[model samples]
Each structure stands twice: as structure tokens, then as C-alpha cells.
Target: MTISQAESHKHLIRTKVWSQLRKVALPDSRFHHDYSSFIADFEGSSAATDLLVSLPAYKNADLLFIAPDNCIQALRYRALKDGKTVLVTTYGIRRGFWILDPNEIHESKWEMASMLDGMERIGRHIALAEITKLPMDIGLMVTGTGAINYKGLRFGKGHGFFDLEWAILYTIGKVNKKTKTIAVVHECQVLDEELRGEVWDTGCDFVVTNKKIIEVEDASKPNCGILWDKLEEGMLEDIEPLRELRSMKK
Candidate 1:
């Protein structure tokens, strides 16, 4: 299928999943828009996080890269409480990346630090060069999904920020073949159909839902770094980290 055709197909799947999630979505006063506009916080988000933390990958990893999605807020809190360092981007990565070191945060503040607004207030913003110099490797990377299939293919909110984040980390050699990737979603978000993923799309090694844990037999991740030619118009000027990263290549 052509790129346009594939995008249309993905849209249909996202619409279907969003519709189902709306019925059981947990009430969050922060959002006023539809589920399609953002990653909706569903009824079983906490349960899914419980199963995620039980995994050997999550237990062994000292550092994690988590997305700033509503559904995975619990995971972020748990990571900090467990004394793990979390690397998170601001919403849409508008402000670039921040590092949340558990040691610096008080135990009473972990819950607040897990939130998006609170993260901005408490987490330390780290520069691209500083990120590359961090001593510890990212052992587990987790992202919230709008929809995912048994094959481990996932679709984000269609903004492509997660894919771009993966590309940046891979380019800097922070994540590699040894890293384990996981997607956390509601059981209703798991679809039965295969998704037509793009070259930049990243897949997961495991899918954790409130219902069960699925280990994808042959899950694949992107090895290529940033495809500068494929970026959206004006993206370099709007995103500070992207702009800095581009100049570094010169």
C-alpha cells in the first residue's frame, strides 16, 4: 500500500480503539478532548503497570525511558519509588528531554514527580550532549500506545514523537540490540489485525495489558537513526534538541 493508504488504514484502527476506550476511560479533569487527541487513561491502567513491573526486564533495569502519556503515569511513579532513573520527554517533546533521578527527589514527591506538570517543575532538564555522557545504559524502554497488534506493531497518537525519540537515542548509542522495549495499553487497545508500519516505526519486545503479558516472538526495532529527509516542515526550528542535533552532524 502507498503511504497515504497505509496512514488511512492506521487511522481507522485508531478510531476503533478510541471508541472502545471511551466507554471505560477513567475520569481525568485534565483533558477535555476526545481519546483520539491524546493517550486516554483507561480503567485498567494501574493493573497493567502492576504486570509490567513484575517482568524480569523491568526489575533488572536501573534506568528506563518512559513516554509522557497519561496511561503510564503509574509506571513512572513506581520507577522512581523503586530507585530507578527515568528519562522522559515533555509533552510532544516541546521542551526536549529531562532526567528524573530518584536520589534527588524526596520520597513524598515521587507521585507528584510522575505527573507531566509536576515533572516540569521538579525534573532536571538535560541537554543532548549531557544525555550522551550519562554513565548508565537504558535497560528498559516503555511507551503508551493507542493501539497494538499481537505482532508487536504499535500506533501512537499519530504525532510520530515516539518514533523520533527512538531515533535520537539510537543515534547517540543509548539503546541497542540488548535493550528491551515494552508497550503498555488497555486490553481493549490490543487489535487482531496486522498494521502496515513505516520504516521509522519501532516495535516492542513485549505487550503488557491489564489482562495478560504477550511476548512477541520476533519483535523488531529500528536500527537506523534520524531520517532527516523524512522530518516534517519547520520541525528543526521548533524543536531545540532537534536543531542542536542537526548542527552536530555538520
Candidate 2:
């Protein structure tokens, strides 16, 4: 498909998923509606998060970099309660990292650390240099795909935060071949169609929903490091963490 065709296809898929999710009525969920899309923070988010933590890879992973998304809160909370270290990034890595170390947090406060704002309140603010110094394991990434094929080909929101976050970890040698990447979304988001992503994009090892988990066999994950040349103007100046990482490369 041409670039325009691809965009139209993605918009259609994303719109369908968002519309369906909005129609869902759940007392347990808190919806965030703004811009052209909406994020329904469904009760199933907990169910899906539970499914992810139950994975053997989740148990084995010592450190994880989880997205600070509303849907991903459960994973962050569970990881901390289980004594695993979590690294959370602000929107686009603009605000750097919040290190959620179970050992450092009081047991009662694990729930607080899971919330997007709570991490900044209670967790340690980790510099890019400090985080790059440690080893990271499996990443329990938050997925916001409009649709994805069974092979785990994912097309997410237009923003490329997840891709850039993975690049930073991979570049620092923190994430290695052993690392497993996973994303949990609603079952409706799983599509039979192959919606493609850019060259710098990475596919998940597993696509999990509250109902079941699908292992992606096709390896479309990006092999090289960050796509520095492809970044939008002033990206290096705007995101502090990326800037720190770039200076290290120099």
C-alpha cells in the first residue's frame, strides 16, 4: 500500500477500536476522552494485566520498563508488589525516568507507585546515565494499537514513544536477546489484518488480552539501534533522556 493508503487503513482500524471501546459501559473503568481518540480505562485492564503478570517470563524478569499509561497501571503495581524493579517514562521520555524499586517503597505504597503521577511522587527520579548503567529484562509495554494480526504485527497510535523507548534500552545494552517484550490490549483490538509499522518499530513477543494470549512468531522487531536521523526536528533538544543518551554515544 502507498503511504496515503496505509494511513487511511490505520485510521479506519483505530477508529473502529476506539469507537467500540467508548460504547462499552463499565463502572470500574475511568475513561479519558480527548483529541481525536479516547482511552477507555476498562475493568478488563486489571484482568489483562493479571494475564501478563501470570506469564513465566514476567516472573523471571528482574527489571521492566513499563509505559506510564492508564491501562498499564495494573502491571506496574503488580510488578512492584512482587518486588520487581520498574522503569517508567513520561510521555515521549520528555520527563525522564521514575525508578520504582519495591525495596525502596513501603509495602503499602505499591499501589501509589503504579499511578502515572504517583511514580513521580514516591519513586526515585533516575537520570538516563543512572538507568543506562543497569541491566533491564523483559519489558511489559503498554499497547494502544488500532488493530493487530495474530502474528503480533501491531499498529499503534501515531506517536512513536514505545519504539523510541525500546531503542534507548537496546542502545545502552540493557535489553538483550533474552529480553521478552509483551503488550496487553482488549480482544477487539486483535485484527486479522496485517497493519504495518515503520522501520524503527518493534513487534511484541506476545499479544495478550483478558481472554487469551497470542505469541507472535514472525520477527518484525527492529534489529538496529535508535533511528536518530529519522527523528523530528529538535527531538534531541526536547527530550532530556534522549539527549543524555545521545551524549553518551558521543
lDDT of each: 0.86, 0.73
- lDDT of candidate 1 over 97-190, digit per residue (tens): 9988889988888899899989988889988889889998889899988899998899777878888888888888899866899998988889
**Which candidate number would show the highest lDDT if scored against the true structure?**
1
Q: TM-score each candidate.
A: 0.96, 0.89
In model 1, what are the clashing residue pairs, if there are any?
Answer: none
Candidate 1, superposed: residue stretches over 4 Å from native? 27-30
Q: Best TM-score goes to which candidate?
A: 1
Candidate 2: residue 247 Cα off by (Å): 1.1
Candidate 2 clashing pairs? none
Each prediction's RMSD to truth: 1.3, 2.7
